[model samples]
Target: TKEHLISVEQGKQYMPTDTTQNSLLNLDLLENSEFSSITRRQFISKWYSFSYWIIFAIIIISYLVYFILSKRSVNPIEIRRRKSTKIAIKRLKNARFCLKNRDFDQFFEEIEKSLWGYFADKFKINSSELSKETIDLYFDKRNIKTETKNNFVSLLNICEFARYSPSKDRNLQMERTLEEAKEIIIEVESDIKKK
Candidate 1:
């Protein structure tokens, strides 16, 4: 009876509005016109903005490698000792060659040079200031053996005399001097180890 009694205009007024359809239309509009999602390729193409950071990181890594390599890791004393030993051995070899060839002038010169050079490198002393007194004082302080000290001092004197004196027997003294030099180096090295 109620359905039959209602009029067309009154029924239209009583019906509720369709809110779901309106909300769906709004979502579609937003997706199409207001906001959009980017693809992976589009995001990756904007690499120019980050290129500076990549270059900076590479430079930092290179400098770190250089620093690590350039830093000295060996003990200073050991470095000095090794360098002195190498130079002395090389000079001794040269002196031996000179002796074999009967070149006494060069032989004495090489021996003297080697001794002075070793002292210079070992004590960080200047070549001009490397005097007998300086070496004696250094050896004295280190408490080197008396025989080693005497052999070192005497060898220097002999080398100097052979260099300056005119009438020296070059061939006769070569073998003994060479042997003494080798012995002195060995003994001094052992004394250094003891200290």
Candidate 2:
């Protein structure tokens, strides 16, 4: 506040006074001989300037692309989720071999594994948490079709039942169950794509 305050001193002193209206000028604008001179400067070539701008534009575009891609980087979970069906199908191929070789136990085991593995990957469910209710939770959350859900459950049940249950027509059952499982996977995959 003290610094901001202004101090003023009052004083008046006079000794002489003179007033003059007419004064002679020392220099005149029109008489100057160097006033009409022109200035010249060096200029770069058109191609050189053009190339500079083009390179700058490319650098800016590339940086923007890098930034955008980095910002939208892929999620590992999403990658696994998208590839779940492919993995399941690959597992089914192994099961198909078992079926062809008449290895019934391995065939059933593979079937069960593929089903559980597919659900685990697709729903992001842990192996320890694999159960009908857990599968149903994700199915209901994702609103999977009732038909697809039923097909999956039925095939799973048959695979589990095949482990201990002796049947006269296991060959037919294997063929039918494998086909149903494939259909169920394809149906769910198509549903995933639609959404």
Candidate 3:
């Protein structure tokens, strides 16, 4: 009987006469006794789920803060100024290529646009609303040299005349105007650097 009891307690075998031992075990369980609290698999599952949520929350919050700060710190004026300069340079290069190809129409248009864009960038003005008189005034207010100012004015005049008049010699005028514009750009850039 003792051997049977030992075998039953070890869970190797059970006998129908072990009713007293089974009742004792049931009473022990009813008293809130725990043989094992949490298994390794259950603990690992809970820890993984908790860490996953924490990492996800951190990533989302970080992106939200970045977006908020970037939105508030944007500078439209600086962006416009940079874009104007880039456009001017690209137009100037295109004008040079057109001049080389004897495309007088495109050359004149691009050169005029480039000049207007350059002035807009230099004076922080809107190119679309700019006029020759406004450009002259801006240069005058900035104390630009008389020679440089006159050269710029003459270049603009040639661009307008060549576009509107349409002469066979317009190609030569475009070449001369492009060179003049390049000189003005160099002088203006130097002036800016000096300031």
RMSD of each: 15.0, 16.4, 9.8
lDDT score, residue 138, model 3? Answer: 84
lDDT of 1 at 193: 79
- Candidate lDDT scores, in order, read 0.79, 0.80, 0.79
Superior by TM-score: candidate 1 or candidate 3: 1
Which of the numbered candidates is closest to the native, going by highest TM-score? 2
After superposing candidate 1 on the true structure, give the runs of residues whose Cα lies further than 4 Å from its correct spot. Answer: 1-69, 73-81, 166-169
lDDT of each residue in 1-195, candidate 2, tens digit only: 356878886558743433332221223332353532221111335557888999999999999999977755567776677788889999899989998998888898998999999999998877899998887778877888878887788888889899889478988888887888898889988876677
Clashing pairs in 3: none
TM-scores of the models, in the given order?
0.59, 0.65, 0.57
Q: What's model 1's TM-score?
A: 0.59
Q: Tens-digit lDDT track for model 3 on 1-195?
A: 355434334465754578889898887676564433444557788989999999999999999999987876597666666566577778889999998898888898899888888888768887576987887788878878778788887888888888888877766677778888888877866665565
| Cα deviation of 172, candidate 2, in Å | 1.8
Best to worst by TM-score, what's the order? 2, 1, 3
